[model samples]
Target chain A: MTEKPLLLLSNDDGFDSKGLKELIETLRPMADLIVVAPSGPRSGSSGAITSQVPLRCSLVSEEPGVTVYKCSGTPVDCVKLALNSFVPRMPDMVIGGINHGDNSSVNVHYSGTMGVVIEGCLKGIPSVGFSLCNHAPDADFSATLPYVRRIVANVLAEGLPVGVCLNVNFPDVPDLKGVKVCRQTDGVWASEFAERKHPHGDVYYWMTGVYVNNEPDAPDTDHWALDHGYVAITPTQIDMTAYGQLKRINDWNWNL
Target chain B: MTEKPLLLLSNDDGFDSKGLKELIETLRPMADLIVVAPSGPRSGSSGAITSQVPLRCSLVSEEPGVTVYKCSGTPVDCVKLALNSFVPRMPDMVIGGINHGDNSSVNVHYSGTMGVVIEGCLKGIPSVGFSLCNHAPDADFSATLPYVRRIVANVLAEGLPVGVCLNVNFPDVPDLKGVKVCRQTDGVWASEFAERKHPHGDVYYWMTGVYVNNEPDAPDTDHWALDHGYVAITPTQIDMTAYGQLKRINDWNWNL
Candidate 1:
């Protein structure tokens, strides 16, 4: 009989988040688990690596088949530390989050959860990022377990293509309408910062934004699926190349 | 007489880098400029947005058609602050970097330079990120001026497509072979952390890596263009969706 697959887990909401705990409870028995996650919440850390300062990691817990470590870095840093140094061997799969907030639409580019998944994909490993639409610290992930298990199993059974990973976002509903493979909705964050005056008379700004979905009615988009109460599974790639514009750019006479 | 174009500028290497200085020197006389950049070096920050902490900005310099503010945030945050609060109006163009190092191939995904550009594109604005292959604190950018001027002129004359921007990397060589619009090359950083022991016995790791280009001979790739002494201009997009894998994923029987 084959041994259980080794799985690496990480999240952006820190190692102590309810989402990470839920993921561990759901997947721990199914796979040999090694978790290396940020010591604190690192939301909006998109594929950031900590190069300015040295990173420190401490082993917090260890079991027969599960080991967890907290690292002083971003989500991508956790994945890098695991893959490059901590893991005994390259894991069969890398899973990030069951994140506290949705990583759909333009959030995919700003998500630390997706950052971990992207790092995994770059290393030629099958990777998946799971996020819930709810942003509360106490958000319940009970509704997402079955879908998560099924998707994780499917990914393990069918490894992803090169340079691609799955970004699965579950709606914050008690009853799910099932899973839909969808495309990223065209969207942008109408970002604004709220300014406040400090006691010292200095002004500080808190980053805030509202996501505006441009294709709200598009059935094939992840945004639509979530709005319709379904789990949205979007296959994401690391290549940012605009293949459609390449020909036109080539036609530009740079020589002149 | 046409009004002078309003330009927004930023960089990952702090407000004091020579690259940023050169950019100001090159573009200042031609356009109205609003510069919002990190107050300190923020390399490897990628597209990170500072959300947990309140950001502070101090006006460093203000002159007719040229104003500069230093922000305590990531590169993306600088652009966000500029667009959302600092700038009186959305600028005609956003320019990032003249970075201290190359942001070619897979580096684009982890670049603070490209982070600013990506943010601009998401906001439906024309954007460009310029990088030099040299990583010195005082790298000679003289060789890059002609190419930079030409590319910036073209971008100003002809705005980029919707949801698209430019990732332009210059070879460090003094001699030039002109420019090539190419695709991002397939590459991964073989990262390793150098472990060290503190004087008090705590362990820390410094992040380091070597980029390995898998397709070194592909003439169509940005890496090849850079290697052959050409300034590589890759038209980058904000979309991370893997359209090629969509149909196959949709066919997956998730119902089971």
Candidate 2:
């Protein structure tokens, strides 16, 4: 008999968030799980790492086939600490999220959920992050479970290409239409701050924005897929090199 | 006669760091400058945003051609805030760093320095991030001044592509070999934590690691250029899509 595959799980939402708890409940039967997640919400942390302070990781809960640890760090830091100190052996797969908010389109750039998977991919591990297009505290993920199982199973069976990980975003609907393999949508967040006068007569600002899609009509993009009630999976890579522009930049005069 | 170009400047190191001051001094003669940087060091912040807290921004210093503001936010936040609320108009270019440490190889994934430029690129602005391969508080940036000037001049005259930015790294040397337009090196940080016993008999960790380069012999990578004492300019993009793997993922039996 072979031992079940070991899966390392984390999320940008705190360890106790409904999204993460739902993920743990769904994945429990498939693998031996070691969950090291931030003790508090760390949304929008992106690929941030804690360097200036010593991190505290405590084993919060332990049960048959499941062990959970809460770390005082960002999602990326949790992944790093888990790989280096917590896991008993190299896990077969690294999974992030079942995030409480949408991580579609350019949100990946500002996502702590995606940060976990990116760190895992950098370590040459097969990684995937899942997000729902909902921000409700008790967002229903029931419709996403079967699709999640299928995708996870496929990734585990086939493995991902080196330097590539999956960014899967489920639309906030009662039922999913289907899954679409799509590219990241070209987009930007516009008018991103709200100015306010503090009680002390000082001006402060709140970070807020409206996403502006540059390619709204592109059916092959994540944004379009999600808008059509489909699960959008973008194969994200760690390399950010603009290879097409390298030659153009090289042609610039460099003589100083 | 054309008006002098406007440049928005920021850095991961706090507003008063020598690196930022050096950048300001060098570019003072070339254009009007507005500097918005974190009030405290925010290394390894990546694209993290400060949504949990209301950010305080203060105008700290004003001079003939230079104005500096310090904000209680990450490097990415500085760029967003500058564009949304601070700048008189969309700046001609957004520039980050003259950082105190290297941001080559996979360091870009965890770099607040690169976050500034990445945010700028997403906003469709020409952006560039500069980093020195030294961590000393008083690191010498004098040798890089001429090269910096040339690169800025070229970029101002010939704007970058819509979705691209530059990540430029200068080696810590008295004389530079030259410039190299390169790709990001494939690398990962290994053994990333040092376990320590807290005084209260609990385990804690300090994040530290050695970079492992997968392709040490790749002459066309940013890592190689930095190692060879050349100024490495890697054209970076905001798009994280793995286009080559799209067809491969689509071929998977995704039927659920």
Candidate 3:
């Protein structure tokens, strides 16, 4: 008999959120699972690590094919802790999210969900992050199950390339319109702060923004795919090097 | 005069750190500067933003050529706030760091210093992040001054390509060799946790690890440049798409 493939799981919305619960339910039967997730919400944490303080992790539950731990750190911290101390062996896959909100386009750079997958990818693991377009804690995730299962199965069958991971987003509609392999849309968040006066007569700001798509007509972009009701799968990479600009920068007159 | 070329600056090491002070002193004569940085240290805060709570920003001082503000948020948040409400006019360039520590190789993925420049690049501005290999609170930054002046002047004169920013690292030496345009070295942090037993008998962990360079002999990488006492300048981009693997993933049997 063959041992089941081990899957390591985490999320930005904490371990008890509906998104992670649904993910655990969906993948538990297919693999021996170990989940190390933040004890509280850590949205928009990007790749933050808690080096200022020691981390506390406790086993939340352990059943036949699954074990879960809650960590007092960011999503990336959970991944590091799990790989360094928690997992019984190297996981076959490192999966993040079923995040409560979409992580498409420029949002990828600011996502704690993506942080988990990026950390895993950096450690040479095949990784993927999943997100729903809806931000509500009780948002329906039934529409994402089949696609998630299929994607997981395919990745398990054919491992991802080195330094590459997947960022998958599902539209909010209950019924899906298939999947589209897409690129990150060129976009920026505009009008990102709402000003308010504090009770002490000081001005404060809250972050709230509308995304401005630079290429709204591009059908190959993740934003367009989500808008068209398709599940978007963007293959994200860890190498941030701008190879195209390297030569241009090399020609600069460095008078030092 | 071309309005002295407005420059916006920020750093991850808090607004009052020696690194940021030196940066301000170096560039004060070259440009009209606005500095908005974190109120306290936010190391390893990679692109993280504050959405959970309202942010408070207070102006610290305003001189003839420089103005400084302290913000209760991450490095990325400071950039957003400055761009949206603080800057008197659109900045000619955005600069981050003169960081107390190096943000080379995989460190860029977790450096809040890099987060500042990445935010600027996404907003379609010429941006650059500068770092010194030394992490000391009072590290000697004299060696980096000339390079900073030249690089900033270069970027100001010739704007960066859309979606590209620079991550420049200076070695800790007093006398530096000439600058080297390099790629991010392939690397990962290994043995990342130091476990400890709590007084209450619970196991906890602290983050501390050694970076394992996957390609140490590669002379064209930032790691190599730093090791040889050269200023390494790496062009970084906001686009995370694995363009090389998109076709490969498209060929996958994503039968959903």
Model 2 chain A weakest lDDT span, ten residues long = A100-109
Clashing pairs in 1: none
RMSD of 3: 0.8
Assess the local accuracy of residue B76 in candidate 1 as a C-alpha lDDT between 0 and 100: 96
Judging by lDDT against the true structure, name the best candidate. Answer: 3
CA shift of B119, model 1, Å: 0.1
Task: After the best TM-score superposition of candidate 3, give how far the Cα of residue A225 lies from its true spot, in angstroms.
Answer: 0.6
Give the per-residue lDDT of model 2 (tens digit) for B1-256: 9778999999999899999999999999999999999998999999999898999899999998899999999999999999999899889999998999999988999999999989998898899999999999999999999998999999999999898999999999998999999999999999899989978898889999999999989999999998888999999988999999999999999888
Report, for every candidate in turn, its global Cα lDDT versus the true structure: 0.92, 0.94, 0.95
Q: What are the runs in model 1 whose C-alpha is more than 4 Å off?
A: none
The C-alpha interface RMSD of every prediction is 1.3, 0.7, 0.9
After aligning candidate 2 to the native by TM-score, how far in Å is the CA of B223 from where it should be?
0.6
In candidate 3, which residue pairs clash? none
lDDT of 2 by residue, A25-112 (tens): 9988989999999999999999999988999999999999999999999999999999998899999889999999889888998999
Candidate 3 Cα misplacement greater than 4 A, ranges: none
State the displacement of the C-alpha of residue B104, model 2, in Å, after optimal TM-score superposition. 0.7
Chain A TM-score for each of the predictions: 0.98, 0.99, 0.99
